[model samples]
Target chain A: MDITNLESMPGKKIVKHLGLVQGSSVRAKHAGRDLLSSIKNLFGGELTSYTELLQESREEAMDRMLQQAKSVEANAILNVRFSTSSITQGAAEIYVYGTAVQLEATE
Target chain B: MSGGSFQLIYVIGLLIVAYLIGSYREKRHYQSIIKREHALNSLPAVNLKTAPKGHFQHELVMGNVTISVDYFKRFLALLHAFFGGPITSYETLLDRSRREALLRMKEMAKEKHAALVLNVKYETVSIFKGSGKSIGSVEVLAYGTALIPSSQAVASNVATTTQ
Candidate 1:
């Protein structure tokens, strides 16, 4: 499926609007990883483990969003957006939302 | 040595060490960011929702980074919070993270040989909230649609419309 953050896909027309499809994931690192991160925080630098964790969470959320689009018979998702919120002390929630639409080639 | 004196000395030592190392690393990161930004200046990323008229292949590209604040900055931030003034220390942290994320996204665009990226967007999240001793960290994500010029142009007979 074609996906873009733009409102409409270029060179294509939105044949049908499938409404909104959304997905979210809440994730947290293990205690050991959290401890390591705090130590790294002492010196200030990039947290590779946290980065990977959030990246994976985003992908998972996007996958679920795509599944919803697929279920609606939409060929593409448009105007996509992402948001992150701290749910608890250590957990983060990644939310992705987009408009599902059927696209037809103008050619 | 008395327990109180030893504890004070240790705290002071930790702050000094943290300040030295943190500033050094931050400087290095800024240097790298500037160098990469200069190198990637050719590839433009814009927030325009509509793609310019053309025959191109569009794909989604994204980059993300998570940066933790050092002990020194965290302490300064706390002071700033109490004093009600700008916390300059954390400013550089966020700036570096945002720039790094955008650079990484542009690098991805370069790898795909895309002419440019459109509809660029950013998401910033302050995670690992300051609780139970650990300080907070920020995560920045940059994403956009890469328009790669197609090698074989589609038939010109097709009517192209943008809405």
Candidate 2:
């Protein structure tokens, strides 16, 4: 599919305006690493545990975004973005969004 | 020991514990900031080249990246405290999410064979907020045309390199 035909391709498909598709998920943990983080902070070093946590959360968000795109029958997505917020001291939300487009040939 | 002296000793012990915990928290927060900055710096620089008119190009795929909010909240809380207010956790969460989204968008550009991503945008919403607690999240979107130089352009580059 040519990039130009990504929009306005023939066939009475349910064309979504602005292709504003979104996906989100919430996660919570029992503050397991807070004490460890405190200790690491005092000693002056990297907190490897938190590094892993961020990575996992980001992946979950992306997966959700992709799933949303698939449901809409979009062959390609453009202008994808992400966001996060705290639900509580120990919980957080990750969200992903993008324009879902169906491609078509220009000829 | 006298009663007054006993009370003094108890207070001193409590202060010592508070000092230890406070110092530890401070140290951990700084360490995380340094790590995140390092990660951001390590990313490769991207360059874009325009494609020729009327020529279709192959699809490109970019790399992937992940980020967490728990780690990010610590940094936000510290920043919020600096401004003389109760530590706010939502700031950190939103910041981390935005960074992760941008990284992922960049990865997609690289994979899609695009030289650059442009016209990026961001949006956020509040999911939960209450007494002594508030939570919200943000989304960032990046979009751009993926392109490669025409055959003629490629040939010229090859000739220049060989010469």
State which candidate has the highest TM-score.
1
Compare the candidates by lDDT and give the number of the best one.
Answer: 1
Could you tell me every candidate's TM-score relative to the true structure?
0.92, 0.44
Per residue, candidate 2 scores C-alpha lDDT tens digits across B50-109 of 333444343332222222233234444556756877664544444554555455545554
RMSD of candidates 1 onward, in order: 5.2, 9.7
Off by over 4 Å in 1: B131-135, B152-163
lDDT of 1 by residue, B27-119 (tens): 899899999999999999998877887778787889999998888788888888788878898888889999999999999888777888998
Model 2 residue B118 CA deviation (Å) reads: 5.1
Residue-level lDDT of model 1, residues A1-107, one tens digit each, is 98888887767899999999999999999999989998987889899998999999999999999999999999999888999988776689999999999999988
Which ranges in model 2 have alpha carbons more than 4 Å from their true place?
A1-18, A41-46, A105-107, B1-163
TM-score per model for chain B alone? 0.88, 0.38
Looking at model 1 chain A, report the run of 10 residues with the lowest lDDT sum: A2-11
